[model samples]
Target chain A: MVIKRKVAVVGAGMTLFRRRMLETGKELCFEAASMALESAGISMRDVDAVVLGSAPDAFDGVHMKGEYLLDGAGGVGKPYTRVFVGGGTGVFAPIAGWWHVASGLFDTCLVVCEEKMSSLHPHPQYAFWGIFDHTLERPLGVNLLWIFALEMRRYMHVYGISEEEIAHVAVKNKRNALDHPCAQLAAKITVEDVMRSEPIVWPIKRLDSSPPSDGAAAVVLASEDTARRICKEPVWIDGVGWSIDSAYWTDRELAYPAYLAEAARMAYRMAGIEEPRREIDVAEVYDPFSYKELHHLEGLGLADKGKAAEMTVAGVTARDGDMPVNPSGGLLGVGNPIAAAGMMKVCEVFWQLSGNAGKRQVKKDVRTGLAQAWGDLMQFSSVIIMRS
Target chain B: MKEGVVKKGQDIGVGRGIEPNPVGSKYAGIEVKESDLRDGRYMSIRYSAMFRYRWDTGIAVGRFLEGLRDGRIVGSRCNVCKRILVPPRVFCELDFAQIDDWVYVYDTGRVNTYSISYIDKQARRMSSPVIVAVVELDGASQGMGIMHLLGEVRPEDVYVGMRVKAVWRSREERKGAITDIVYFKPL
Candidate 1:
């Protein structure tokens, strides 16, 4: 494994995830970026470069959304780049920032990820209609729910899992969110309540879904030299890896996330982590749907296949339990603002590793943690490993 | 299609039942100084995109639409997978192979699942709850359901595995859109 220069997360910031924000996308980016800079005790003038990530321009009804969010993110005249991989964009944004510092091209970099799904008309999910092949798939008038439902069905079939078993994830994540300050749907509920709730698609209920939200998150990354000199308890970026599979989502097995496994393996290998379940203290896996968290848990090697859901029910993933996952309440509990959702996970990992997660802190001494985001028809996966 | 205009005149001595357009519409505009505008402040660069769709699933979808236009329902079968896909696809998902053959299916199915959406996408309040459901078409693969509107069942009555069938609009009101099937009702 090639060892790159060390980089550290000096600070992080995020706007409240919500259904609507009167602030435009650029304004939200500015708010988050400014807060991140303040937290880092630095100014935009000190930043050497900037990296921005946003999921889709379609959701904002603005093409080249990165460019639109540039100035607000302090990318006006600096060496800046916009990187995107759907919902994976947010986590990937920090990875890109890490590379900027790790490559020794810059000593400090500002990373920003933002999404405004509320701006899309009809429904933001309607934007997903075009995510399909315009020639082949769009003709069917397929909605986004179909793909998720089909994946959920296949996951259930292959894992010998029942809908009731999956409902426990909704119960756990929502209950966990009760302590999250930025959570949108934080509540205490039961598996019985999830099963009794109205289903949007078979095996996928309204409660199982992440709400459309408008939010932004920003993180400031710096070289080891700059980090040590300027800040205390800088969370080091131990390893970063991202991968994208073929866009032909239907051809792949929906029951398993091969891309995520590949991405996690690459990051873990670089981080020299031989056994993830034992070494990693906490995790912030993406969970846009309740089943996805369990699915990703398996893919990240935290648990064996067909075992994540069971482990979840056994309370192994609770904030106070071993191998705590999504202690930040996750996308299922906190609202999912797409790009921002991934960065929110990264921010949570930073807070947890820095001993800043006040109420939702995990029980273990979190010396190392991992955050992963998957998106783009389940084809893109990004992983980041951070250590104190 | 037919197009025309209708005109109605007032009865005796009411001067054509017409009134002048209402006035007093208020409009306000403000201008700010360049200095007050926050010079060098952040301003987003704008961009736009337009996409044209030439979908070929039209052949199978056309048949499905025609079925709705005629008060029937249809789907397509994947010969390789042997699974009938409603709102059918042109290719088989499992094999990633072409699916050229189309199969007609009965409208009768079951409400495999459903949700009562209190608010629309815009967060607007609806006068009545909208029942969005997944209806597993007859002869389709197990657990396979096409999303559609549901009616004639209270929110509490709608449950998984409840049998239902499509309710089409009047023939004269038929359109190629999914809305052509007004809603689904208990079988």
Candidate 2:
């Protein structure tokens, strides 16, 4: 028990995840922020502060991006701030907002995250090349997929897992996305189709990955008293934790994410959840690739090491499974807009816990749920727990 | 604080969500639609540039580069952890101590993991695929793989734990870069 005020996510809003949209990054933030304020039954005037999140200056093709997106994020004339942790910024933005309200500094906080990956030429993936070690790894002509592919192969080799077994996650998530209104690449794909799909890198295929997207997401947070007054049901962020490993990614075993496990341990301790496999009702994890969902699940302690892929094989992570994950289609199906996609995970938890996710609702009666996002050379993990 | 002139949209109404207005209605009376932008009613344009950087490859990386230029693979060994770090650095990230010594590692190593890349770094499809592997050098440590291209082997034949050795360019061709080593060939 910390002596901080409790914080609740009163409302959330998001634009459809798509390959490209007419809206610029700021415009996207405005639409999502406005919708979120409306959902909370309030206008921007009622908010005391604002927090924003987006990944990379290269993707948006601008510098000083925090202030660039300020007015559209409803941050003008308020205590505005920005938080960035690459892909982890999605969940991390709300976590920042959580502390803003919890610290008694602001009664209401607006959190917005946006990414316009289409603005980058060649492709969004090209912007990722800049993140590697400029002196060492970059000179080798490396790309983002190479690292993910390397990690996936190591994980498979260590645990004796197969690509075919991992393809099941693609099948499950795409089918799950068919029910999501904002999904970009939702389809009835099969493991066979995944096996036959074109490979970008041998282990990572076209269907196995999330599409590059341009989108934005927003949420409104308020103190306990304010939430009770403004919302009929406010989803409580019971716990939050984040951890980042060394930048020397190659030094550690690529098969597992010790960073995420450490973060999950801290969050579970704060929430008083000892048996995560049984206690957590549902989850929405970062899944830019299908193998990533399994990797993150094990990291979250919801499944044992080497068991996440087996659970996917058993259909245990389905919408109706004992502990469902990614009920809103996840990044693989919805779209990978980086920071916005991470924020979308927070939105999914809010929607699921409040019974507001219309067609993509998990069969489980979810009173407690978790959302997580990983970023930066497989080194960072952020977690947020919510209860209805 | 002013940007562009805004025109009224025909779809404005109570509870109709004015967010669809592309030019913004922040001033209460200002709004514009997608059609107005098409008709050149508002002024907005795209801008781009090619930015470059000249980063100083300090201490650790500098030594690593020097070693590569001399046709040798070097690693830093920490006395406290007793682990050798390839692509050598000056200090151990886990322990806050400076490394005790620079150790020479065998160029031969086993592939930890690899990928057959059909696309270039820019996400453009390549005419021919490149084979990239994370090779854990024999003396550096397990899981500490230096990422490099693989050559003289079929893509299907490249597997985890497969033995490989560096295929270097001629000494005259050395450029003090990771490309100094052309590719790793199967031993």
Candidate 3:
């Protein structure tokens, strides 16, 4: 083992995820940061550094999104860094905070992620067009869903999976979301409902996808000594890992996410979790699309390849199941605001490990949990393991 | 630091800070319906990114475009990996070596995967669905695909591994761009 300094998430908070929020991006950051500080029983004076995570600057129509969101993130004068890994930024921001504490450079760090996708005109989805390659992919006039659909198709063809099997994820996640106060698309829909929904791209229905939302999530990370002094029970970030693959997404195999697997391996190795399925009590895998939840679970080594869907179908991934996943309703039900969605997973895991997750809490005692997020043209993954 | 505001150090509380009685009980954030924006109830400013510049296509892509203008799909081959990178690159990401050998790939290819896109890049509904496919061009490394539009085929008719050929515009209409090859049609 590396025998590094311990770091823990002392407090966590988030605003409601919605299609459009009246609060400006800065206000949203402030509100979430305030709630997190209050939860930790601390004030701005206690924070030694600040880290902000947000998606594309174009989404907010701002040139410098990090600097623009500085004051609200409690980073006005403190040592600050803005981290972005597309949607993976949520966990990545906290990981940056972990470095601040773990590096013994700061006693306490505040990590905040905010995304106001509604600011972009002609729908927030339009902002993603810039993510594709300008020379080859952009000239084809591509939509984001088209690529996801292509990936989903490849996964299905390889595994002999059916759309019905994937629809079950949407059904389960939406139902689980009903208990979440911050959820935007909570419902009691069935697989048939998902199958009948409007198809944005073939193999991907409207119900199978998360909504474009404007929201923010935050967490306060503290050094072990500071955590012991301030919080009664802190969720320790036992492991943190992130990896990014090639930008030539077309050349890679869409059937599996090799980058996410590499990231998960890195996290598991640090956490000393050789058997993720047995050791991990709960997980919040990214579910931007219904199939992605299964895809990520497989990538995280929480389930066997081509078997995550079976776990969902068999109730092994339910709220009360053996290895509960997405007890926060995930991005599919809760709403995805790019970077904030990943941060929301980190917050959910913190709450889960600390026994703070209320109705959405898993049935069994959860001592260890993981939050993983994928982003940037299906090429990036960030994982954080938390233990109480 | 605001004008006329009392400094915390000069306050009567001194070392003991005043108690904060936070008021609102609800979670943070105020939700607004889309109608509010249309009605102008909540103020908003319409802004667009004003700055724009042309990207230099660079050495590898510059030649690739030249090849397309001449009715050919050019790729660069890495001697170390022996892999022909489509939509050519000056360097091989895997081998970490510069690639100078330019290979002309067959215009025909097989569809690796595809989608019937009912929405455009702006998420706007299109009158007719645009069929998009990742075509792995022949003579290039296996799985070395480039994203392009699929045409002259129905959405239901498209399948993985479907052989297709590029439908290029006439010589006069040719421009040194990806659009010169309009779409790929089933052979």
Candidate 4:
């Protein structure tokens, strides 16, 4: 892939993840976008274009959430675009901003992702019912937990992986979140706690999942010239890749995420990374569920198939380990605001690369890192590789 | 004296200026308690979608539904792949070719995977849990499964490969839908 102009992330900012925020989605976007602009030492007047990402309008009870959030994202008169790929929208937003800068069409772009899950009635999980097949699956009175529980069960059944092994991911990530100011469920809990928690669905204890949250995150992307001129330590976007699998998720093997592997391979190839495990310093793989972190790690080629749990048990994925994963605690601890959660991963990688992550910084001097997010009926994945 | 003091534009909109919000202390959002929403401390408007519409099940699933009404499970086969798809499709996803034939699959199938859901569709905790499973029917292609409920088996007794047969509802209660069969019970 020949490049027109290199794109780099100059600044990143995010709001604290919470269960119920009085602020509207537009307000959340404004807070995040303003902080990002301030961190970049630039004003909204300097922004050439804007890219916004938010998950389902059903959650916000507002249709056309992107257009509703445009002004808050500093997109009043500039070229604006809204990109949503389910939960992958957060990372996909930056990938869109990368396009505007890398195409030489815009010198500076502001990327913002926001989600207000609290506005939905009954419960946020209720909104997911619309995602299923109304005829084939909905008639079964399906709940979202059924799919994740089934997937987690299949992954365990296939690899002979025990629920105890998966519980360690939640324990590790929650403990790691203690230093995060924006963390929602950060804690120091044992695997026994996870095992003893109420079973929302068999094989899926309450503690094994991230809580629904309301938050927003933003990052500023600039061209090579703009990055060098304005910021001292801009994180260059080394590679970006996204892919979607067949929509019929039930027909595919639940134990492995083939779509994520295809996306990771595309990114690794573009970044010229032959050995992901050895070359990449850290990763913030999506972990909406504890098993998902392991699932995604295997899919990203950071660990061998079905061996991620074993690696986690061996202290290989700890913040102090050789390859730290989710050093910012991840969605499991920070919270899952859908689109914002994915964007938070990208912001974490940017912060980690710039050495701006204060107490959440890993032990190693990381030069290169990767951030990945999965969404859309267990079918879509977006990957971004960055280097300081 | 108070009536004679007519000073215009002297403190008009003075204190409504924007206050600088420090990143660490006072962030942008306000956290409201759930009770606040209930007590009407914050104004909220209720809106419900009136999306009443019919969805065309199309030829493949349309025929499949008709077959279910007649006490038979129908599937379409792509001769290129030589596999019958349950919840049949008109076009082969992999082969990208038109289906060659439609076949009748068995009412009995093995459980591919199952979940004991403690919550209902509205995310409300249920008094009795529902046992949902992906049953890979016999006479269908390998790994092709349909999601349905399980009955006549203890949740603790359910296993991954348990063979189960559909327990059809009464003929008078039968609707040309996937729910025509009440639930799958242990064979």
Candidate 5:
């Protein structure tokens, strides 16, 4: 809100999203961080600070994970910090990097987000059980899908929607992933395939969800003057916003994500975006589940309430369609490594805006783009708008 | 030959580098099978850590749990906002004022939302599905609900706005926990 130096995304890189990788979490961080530095044409000597984002130490099977990932994140001898807001940390981490540069404290910041869900024994979904109220909800034995399915069902019931319609988001995103080099679940499937897939929950089929993955993503954010000197075309961080709702998630309606809308409003207001549906050329929203892409689209006001599904069914969210969403295949198409998934969205937006997204680039001429993430039992949301 | 002659460029390490995939050829990573990992073929270390929490439920939750043990549903009233919260809290998060009093709410309410879960906390498949629901207590304010189980009905039969009542355990068998009420059954 006050006067400060500007920040620009000069480089971004990501490792392959997979179910299990030979490299450990710290090793994955090094891979992505080094690639990001190479892409920016700057070495670690140019980066003055490091900010890492990852979700659930339980998944990594480690504690004080920020400190653990420091060396691999290229923070061996620099101002280092770790930001965690559940799954929102990926995009939120960059907002932290932006702060370090915007505050004039650091000229260049290397932001890294990684998640090795493979460390979660049995399955990564089990780690989410700890997220519940240890006393109240845990004794009832609830899994993550229960809440997501309940919300999906409620959204369908309230709007008279159907599972068949929601399946189309998965269809679009997975197909879009066919063009993504980092995608883990990229496949060409029909809505019928989605409908026929094994049911995890009544409304959520197996194919409708993103796979738990091991991966890492990194980005280099530099101050305006540094960006001008290092790169010819730097993607400016136009505005950033984040918000959290009451932790009493069950006490609120599941049909809409009010927190995300609040976050979007904060970001749009800061970016001076009066009409998001028109002004923002593209968006890379968090879509761990297929319905979520549609849900966030509505929350971002890119589509009206209960209209996102209709728009998706009409091919309005396709790469070639108007206001394309998840052009990098989203989390559903790409794998979900929690924090890395959100960071990948930021990279996707940066790529889309810079005209560097090869096969997944949108047909529309992109200028201003928005990226958002939601997590922590639907409590926290991080939104960022960028321009080239 | 009495002595062995070594080559100049000796290669001993396994050449299992990153795999080649036409789908995403540019991205780099390594992969292994589950078989190799399960039988100690892959050198690794494993251990377990135990954590037990003695959480203090504090004022509102302590009273709320006490109410559950008494076979009653209770909510706290924020005097300023006058909103009755079912899963009660001490201070009004919005008003930042202490809640005035605890009020008893009906055990019967409509199912605000429900889900049929087939997996347990460990992500293991259950033999039969469990119906979980968010019951909006009758006397509680709109959308103020708690996560609980639903019973005595099929998953397809469960719907939003379906009237339901809590099936509580015997008073003598009750503990001051949420499980005091087994599950909610449709009316």
Candidate 6:
């Protein structure tokens, strides 16, 4: 057994997700970090270390963004480090913070994730070009949507699923976002509405996508002793796991997230969870694209392979449903700020486990929750399990 | 590595072919002057870049953009979810789905949520404060709304659920952007 110290999340905070934000990346970081500290009823002086996570430096048009954001994140002159694995950076930030406390190196840590995708000119999707190989892949002039469309096509083919079925995830999530204060694109629509919507790429319509957004989220982590002394009802970090797959995306099957499954297995083993569907009360799966939610649900072991879409169609994943996924409306409805979007999922899990979710509360008593974020050309996965 | 040399006036000529001396200038005494040039050091530089992508709004979003230019709001309905989506999209989000039903929405909507921006991305002060808001259409669901600018209301007066109406720019001034609709005013 790895003799890791107990870790708890004592505070959480976030800025509203939007397509464009007047606040620069640093300002957003400072605002969110300050709020997290305040929510814990502690000051920035109480934080012993800092871990910063931001998706692509291209999104902000800044190089070595970690160092540039240091002052705003309150990491200046402290034991600060930056870690990123594309979209997974959000949840990974807190997990990194967990290690700082779990290793008994720091009593408290401030974890922050920020992304300003709106700053990228001619559309932020252009920034994704660098995610490919400079020599071999860049010459192809591939857009990020091409890959997602190809994967979506593969998923539909393997599962015999229709585009209409996957559209329900968008409908449900956007509807659920009705109660979310920070939602960017929340709406109530039907299957016919989705089917009739304009197509961006074949199979991926305008409605199936998450918008380019600007936002930041932050959380405070502490050791068991520090948690007990500083806050009430601390959410325990029972397990944390992350994994990366090969960069050669074409070499792997696009129909499933094998990396996510492995990452979830590692987390489950550490958290002592055998039957995730039964043990976990709520979930926040990354849904940059609507199909990703179902894809991730299967990866997280919450539903069997090729069955997540069916469960979603059956209303089992709604806020009042048995599983209650994306209670914060998820990245689909709530807006995806990349790194910040993943942290939003973590924050939703924290809120649900603590019964702090006001209007969006699920209909069951929750004790355990799971949150996962995926990114990097579909190569990385990060999982975190929390318990009250 | 292989070593090779050229002999003056033999394999290679120094000047004026065979007519001139291979070694042109000669000094009476050779004085070696060495200066301390070791103080400078070489530095390596690094560069990074991001890719760019072009997105097409498709027919539905194209129509929606046209509507914005025409001073109208539009939404599409999903047969499966049975909800209206503003800024009409061609597919649903939940099930990897598609939507074909389109509906024109009324300009009347209520403020769902809003924020007052005091600065731009450059951290530059604005001549006037800008109020950005999400407005839920009258018949739309609770969360359904279009994000746009709010005008004619003081920052202090803007509140959640405040009923408002869209104010469009002149036909000549419209540019098919969100800014085409100057702002929303309290109804």
Candidate 1: tens digits of C-alpha lDDT, residues B19-131: 22224311111112224234623222444466764555467667776777777766677888787777676877667888877777788887654556554433344567666
Q: What is the lDDT of residue B13 in candidate 6?
A: 33
Q: Report per-candidate DockQ.
A: 0.05, 0.38, 0.62, 0.64, 0.69, 0.01
Cα displacement (angstroms), candidate 1, residue A187, comes to 0.9
Tens-digit per-residue lDDT, B1-187, candidate 2: 2345545664434332223432432211113334655776554466778779999988877888888899999899888888889878888888888875998899999998888898999999999889988898988966677889999999999999999999988999998898999999999
Cα deviation of A148, candidate 4, in Å: 0.8
How much is the lDDT of residue B147 in candidate 3? Answer: 88
Model 1, A162-190: lDDT tens per residue? 88888888888888888887787898998
lDDT for predicted candidate 2 compared with the true structure = 0.87
- DockQ score of the complex predicted as candidate 3: 0.62
Q: lDDT score, residue B70, model 1?
A: 74
How do the residues A1-388 of candidate 6 rate in per-residue lDDT, one tens digit apiece? 6746899999988887877665678988987898788878899888899999998888777989999899989998789999998989988999999999999999999999998887665478777877864432344334566567656766776787888899999999988898887778888978777788766544677788898888889999999998999888899999888988765465356678989999999999999999999999999999988899999999898999899999999999999999999989999899999999999889888888888887988899999999999988888999999999
lDDT of each: 0.80, 0.87, 0.89, 0.89, 0.89, 0.80
By summed lDDT, which 10 consecutive residues of candidate 1 chain B come out lowest? B25-34
lDDT of 2 by residue, A1-388 (tens): 5738989999998877777666778888988898789889999889999999999988877888898999889998899999999889999999999999998999999999998887776588888999998888888788899889888988999898899999998998888889877778899988999999999987999989998888889999999999999999899988899999988877778889999999898888888888988889999988999999999999998888988999999989999888788988899888888888998889888989899987888887999999999997789999998899
Summarize candidate 3's per-residue lDDT along B122-176 as a digit string, tens digits.
9888888888888999999999998889989988999899999999999999888
Provide the TM-score of chain A alone for each candidate, in the order shown. Answer: 0.98, 0.99, 0.99, 0.99, 0.99, 0.98
Error of 1 at A91 (Å): 1.0
Number of the top DockQ candidate: 5
Q: Candidate 1 or 5, higher DockQ?
A: 5
Q: What is the DockQ (computed on Cα atoms) for candidate 6?
A: 0.01
The alpha-carbon interface RMSD of model 5 comes to 1.2
Output the better candidate (3/6) by DockQ.
Answer: 3
How should the candidates be ordered by TM-score, best one leading? 5, 4, 3, 2, 1, 6
lDDT by residue for model 5 (B1-187), tens: 1135647786543533433544636555665457768864555567667887889988888898999999998899999999998799888887999876889999999998887887888888899999988899899998999999999999888889999999999999998999999999998
- Backbone collisions counted per model: 0, 1, 1, 0, 0, 52
Clashes of 2: 1
